[model samples]
Target: MTNILVVNSSALGPHSVSKALVDNTVEKLKLSHPDANIVIRDVGANPIPHLTADNVVPEPETDAQKAARSLSDELIGEVQVADIVVLGAPMYNFGIPSTLKAWFDHLLRAGVTFRYTEAGPEGLLKGKRAIVVLSRGGFYSEGPLQVLDAQEPHLRALLGFVGITDVTYVRAEKLAISPEERESSIAHATTEVEAVVNQVSAAA
Candidate 1:
């Protein structure tokens, strides 16, 4: 049975385009693999605390630090057990949201998710697939605005650092441009999502 973990980090909550895409994707995955175990972590709704010196250092600390550590363990445990990870990452100010960044910070643990070797730092979590659903106000997949967009590339790099190299992206862009453009973008993204679902189903 496949274990899927869905992580949402859109401040827009129920009205978020990224969340909608992720929801569609998850529903398709369920259709394909009815026995799959799916878990959700809504970072935007319940934001994880940012990493502090106390939490990182791993020593005797206050109650807050202990709570943070426990949460980190739960977050990492979920990733470790998941066969596939789905992320709803919306661009904010040309970058990723702070809520997602905080979750990433907690997962970056030495001698756990990654470790420094003689050559360089090597990721320990391997053989995992990731699907990132991105929603952007402007076109950033290509053209002049691409350089200014840090959301996709940063997520790719960070996920790859944790050994999740098998990654796919479904993007809904040109939002906030016009109602027609938003509709077109969403329609295109929905098609892409269907294609992704077909591919994953075939693989299964």
Candidate 2:
């Protein structure tokens, strides 16, 4: 059975557009693979502690550091075992949420998830697919604002660093612009999600 990992990084909880898109995508995936195991980690609700000196150091760490390391291990383990990863990431200040960044910090471990090679750094975890659902207040999919949108590029770089190069993005833009814009954005995203589902189903 396929092991699917869903990471939610929206403080708005159920009201988040990213979460809604992810939920719809996951549901479609389930229909395609009934036996797939889905695991969810809500980073926004239970934020991961930011990386600190104690957590990075190997000797004589504090209790908080130990806890942080443990959580990091767990997060890495999830990524290691997942066949497909789904991220519900909303743009915050033209970037990803700090909670999601903290999660990425834990997963990007040296000698574990990635290591330096003669040519460059090589990722250890291979053969995994990642799907990112992004919700934005402004229209950053294209045009001048696209240059300022760092969320998708950051996620792609970080995930690629960990060997997840097959990444797809489903964007819902201009969500806060107007009621009509919000509806159209969500509808377009939903269509994209369905297309992805159909593609995955066919591949399966």
Candidate 3:
């Protein structure tokens, strides 16, 4: 059986294009692997508290820190146990949402998710694949605006840092270009979800 972990980080809730993309992606995965167990972390609806002085892991192990650390442990465990990870990210001001960033901050732990060695730093969580669906308001997939698009690159680096290097990207761009373009991008992403599921089946 496959273990799939999904993260939805768009604040728009019902009206989110990214959430729609994520739902489609999960449905495709289900069709491919009927026995797969899915765990969803909806950070948009319940945002993880940003790491602060109070929540940072402490040697003394304060009550607040303990609760924060436990949540981090749970988040890291989800990624470690999953065979596939599907996440939806909507661009905000040329970058990713702060809520999503907070989730990453909690999951990334030294000697837990990653480690340092003689060769160099290495990620601990291996043998995992990530499918990221990104929604952008402007033309950021390619062209002059690509450089300004910080969402995908940041996500890629973070995923790689945790040993999820087999990453695939599905982009919904030019959402704000026009109403017709928004609908077109969504229709295109829906097709992408099906393609991704067939293109990469469960590794057995």
Candidate 4:
């Protein structure tokens, strides 16, 4: 059976496009892999605290630091056990949400998720696939606005650093353009979700 880790990082709560897309994506994933075990992390609703000097340094830790360390361990363990990681991210100020970034920060432990080699840094967690759902208010996949897109690149680099190179992106853009555009974008994205099911099935 496959282990699917579903992470949603949109602070919009019930109104979040990214979170809804993630739900739709996961449903399709479940259809493709009926026996897949699902694990959920709703960081948007329950945001992870940003790393402080106390959390990152090697000095004697306070109770809060210990809790932070334990949380990081748990986050890393989730990624370590997942065969498929599904991420929901809505663009915020040309980048991903702070909660999601914090989640990534916790997982990127030296010698744990990655290690330094003579050749270069090597990712320890290998053989995992990531499906990232990105919702944006404007076009960023290509064209003039693409240069302003810091979201996808950051996520790709972070995931790649941890050996999740087989990453796929599904985007819903032009959301805030107009009502017609929003409807069409959502329809396009909904149709695109079927392709993901096919892709996963083919890999199986």
Candidate 5:
């Protein structure tokens, strides 16, 4: 059976546009993959600890800290078992949330998710697809606000680091511009989600 890992990192909880988009995407996936085993990791409500000096100090940790470190290991293991990874990543100060970044730090382990090769670096986890659902308050796909978009590019680079080159981004921007625009943006994204679902279903 195909396995999927869903990571939700919207600080706004159920009210978040990014989270809603992710949920819709999952629904679409289920329509195609009826037997899909999906695992959801909600990093917003229960965030993993940031990698502090104590955690990465190259020294042994206390028992309690060691237990906390185990959480990161488990999350990385989940990625290894997944065939697809879906992320709900919203723009925070033109960047990704700290929680999502922490998840990446845990998964990007040497000799595990990646390896240092003579040619440079090679990813260990292959044949995985990632879909990032991005929601931004303003339009950033072009013009002046474009440079401020750190969400999509950062995710591409980091996920690609782990050998996930089959990646797609569904961006819902200008959500806060006005009520009409917000509704229209969401509807458009929903159509895109449906199209992707049809494609995946046909391929399946």
Candidate 6:
């Protein structure tokens, strides 16, 4: 069975566009591969603590550090075992949420997630495809709104650092302007999600 890891980073919970996208993608995946193993981590609901001096102080491991490290290890293990990863990232101040960044910090350990080689830095996690579902209040797909899209580039850079270059980004933009535009944007994004589902299913 194919193993899929899904990360949902939306503070809005069930009402979140990002969560909706992830849900739709998972539904599509189920249709394609009923036997697939799917694991979901909702970072926004159960927020991960940001790294601090205590995390790297090298003293007796505190409960906070231990918990943080444990969560990070689990996340990394999930990625290592998964055949595909789907992530939901809602833009915050033109960047990723603090909770998501915290998750990244924990997963990105030196000599574990990545290492420098003669050629360049080699990411340890390989043979995995990642899809990031992003939602924005304003239209930031292209052209005039391009400059406001820090979410896409930031996610790509961080995931790429972990050797996940085969990544797809599906965006649900202009979600807060009007009811009509929101619905239309969501429909368009749902179409993209279906396309992604088919693509991944075919490859699998």
lDDT (Cα, tens digit) per residue for candidate 2, span 1-204: 999999999999879999999999999999988999999999988897888876787753788778878877899999999998999999999999999999998899999999999999999989987889999999997899999999999988998898999878999999999999999999999999999878877877
Give the 10-residue window scoring lowest on summed lDDT in candidate 1. Answer: 52-61
Candidate 3 lDDT by residue in tens digits, 37-106: 9999999999988888765645527888778777888998999999999999999998899999999998
Q: Please report, in order, the local distance difference test score of every candidate based on alpha carbons.
A: 0.91, 0.91, 0.89, 0.90, 0.86, 0.88
- Stretches off by above 4 angstroms in model 4 are 59-61
Candidate 3 stretches greater than 4 Å from native: 58-60, 202-204
C-alpha lDDT (0 to 100) for residue 44 of candidate 5: 86
Which residue pairs of candidate 2 clash?
Answer: none
Q: Cα RMSD (Å) between model 1 and the true structure?
A: 1.2
Local lDDT at 24 for model 6: 92
Candidate 6 TM-score over all chains jointly: 0.93
Q: Which pairs clash in model 4? A: none
In each prediction, how many residue pairs overlap at the backbone (N, C-alpha, C within less than 3 A)?
0, 0, 0, 0, 0, 0
In candidate 6, what are the lDDT values of residues 154-187, reduced to their tens digit? 9988998888989989999888899999999999
Flag regions of model 5 displaced more than 4 Å.
57-61
- Model 4 over residues 1-204: C-alpha lDDT tens digits? 899999999999999888988899899888889999999999999998888865786743788778878888899999999999999999999999999999998999998999999999999889988889999999998899999999999999999998889888889999999989998998888788778767877897
- Pairs that collide in candidate 3 are none
| Position 40, candidate 3: lDDT | 98
User: For residues 1-204, could you state the per-residue lDDT of candidate 5 as single tens digits?
Assistant: 999899999889979998899999999899889999999998987898777654554444787567656766798889999988888998898999999998888888788799999999998889888888888889999999899888889998888888998877888888999999899999988888777667666766
Per-prediction TM-score to the true structure, in the order listed: 0.96, 0.95, 0.95, 0.95, 0.93, 0.93
Work out how many backbone clashes candidate 6 has: 0
C-alpha RMSD by candidate, in order: 1.2, 1.3, 1.3, 1.4, 1.7, 1.7
